[model samples]
Target: MTLGTSTSPLHYYDVSSVDGFNLQVSMVPVGGGVGCGVTGCETDLNICSPSTFE
Candidate 1:
């Protein structure tokens, strides 16, 4: 995602799990201003640790 314009209102975003991931993900940018920031993968990944999915 990419957005900028409206006199330079900018926000570029990316969140991926390389085609696989189970649950827990986030991005919050409400009332954006002054470096609108928040992005995440609050890990649960189906109880990860099976060799970290190789």
Candidate 2:
């Protein structure tokens, strides 16, 4: 899991499968935020990227 910060109007991410074979990705925005300032941000983004050899 990794956290990324961007102020750009548009953001793009490239998620590739193992060894750039599958190129699949799972993305979603964070929830609640509660007291934190981050009310809208991609959270728990999982990219089960794996190498084809593996």
Candidate 3:
């Protein structure tokens, strides 16, 4: 059997986003000689303050 053809760009995977119960990792260039690994972005933020009461 033969597979179908892909009309999208070679780097199409890096230019797309996913949504749902599944998890995926994506990389995108930021600037000169630099790139970033972005995933589970919700956990990468400071949504709460440090412990104050013990």
lDDT of 1 by residue, 1-54 (tens): 788789876668888877757666789988888877888888877676586585
lDDT of 2 by residue, 1-54 (tens): 334457543434444443534343455545624432322223332444244344
Q: Tell me, by lDDT, which candidate is best.
A: 1
In angstroms, give how far residue 25 of model 1 lies from its true place.
Answer: 9.1
Is 2 or 3 the stronger prediction by TM-score? 2
lDDT per residue for candidate 3 within 4-48, as digits (tens), equals 358632331222223321233444444423333343333322234
Please give the range of 10 consecutive residues that has the lowest summed lDDT in model 3.
9-18
TM-score for each model:
0.34, 0.23, 0.18
- Candidate 2 TM-score versus the reference: 0.23
- Pairs in steric clash, model 1: none
Runs of candidate 3 with Cα error greater than 4 angstroms are: 1-22, 33-54
Q: Which predicted model would earn the best TM-score?
A: 1
Off by over 4 Å in 1: 1-10, 19-35, 48-54
